[model samples]
Structure formats: structure tokens, C-alpha cells
Target: MSDIEFPDTLIALERAAWEELQAGRLTVATANAVQDAITQHAEAAGMSRVEVEMALKKAVRHAEG
Candidate 1:
């Protein structure tokens, strides 16, 4: 993994998504919400939205394994 760092909001949002998934409540809508949150955070932080999205997707996939 790269040394890229995420903003607190993005990290919190990802954590929430993982929690929801663990709780068996991660619906498509919830996943979309997480993505939206990431977008918002990326914009606020002046970070690359694509990078953050990719990182979050990778995180979700890793969590599944």
C-alpha cells in the first residue's frame, strides 16, 4: 500500500461502512452513502477523489476477505 493518508472524515466514514457491514446492515444505499461521504471529504481535503474511491473499494474488498 502507498503512504497515502486519508482525512479523518473519510476514515470515519469507511469505519462506519465496515461497522454496518459487520452488523449485517450494509445495504446498497449505505454503500453509496459511504462513497458519497468519501467524495465530499476528498473535495474538502483537495485530495484525488479517484484515489480515495479506489482506496475505499480496496479496503472493502480486503475486509470481505
Candidate 2:
């Protein structure tokens, strides 16, 4: 489990962006939204961008449903 609690906005943007990526239809706007959200979340949470991103990926992809 991750110690960091990411915001729903960031998670949703990332999830949507990821789906676009898989479809090879990712737009610059979507990618930039995810990037911007990540940076904001990292700054707000006082964690490195990479740490937050990795934790987010694990949370989204590996979390048991």
C-alpha cells in the first residue's frame, strides 16, 4: 500500500491518458494534463514527481479490486 494518497483528479486524468496511449490516440493536451496534475500532486504532497507517479501507477494497475 502507498503512503501517499493521490487526488481523484490526478488518477482520473492518468487513467484516461493511459487509455488513449493504449489506443495510440494520446493527445498532447491529455499528456500535458497528466503531467501538470502529477507535478501539482507532487508539490502538494511533498514527494518527488517520480515517486508519486510510480505509486500512482501501482495504485491504478496493481491494486486489488
lDDT values for all models: 0.73, 0.87
TM-score list, all predictions: 0.54, 0.87
Off by over 4 Å in 2: none
Clashes per candidate, residues 3 or more apart or on different chains: 0, 0
lDDT of model 1, residue 9: 63
- CA lDDT of 43 in candidate 1? 88
User: For model 1, what is the C-alpha lDDT against the true structure?
Assistant: 0.73
Model 1, span 27-57: residue lDDT tens: 8877787788878867876888888787875
| Candidate 2 TM-score, C-alpha based | 0.87
Measured by lDDT, the strongest candidate is 2
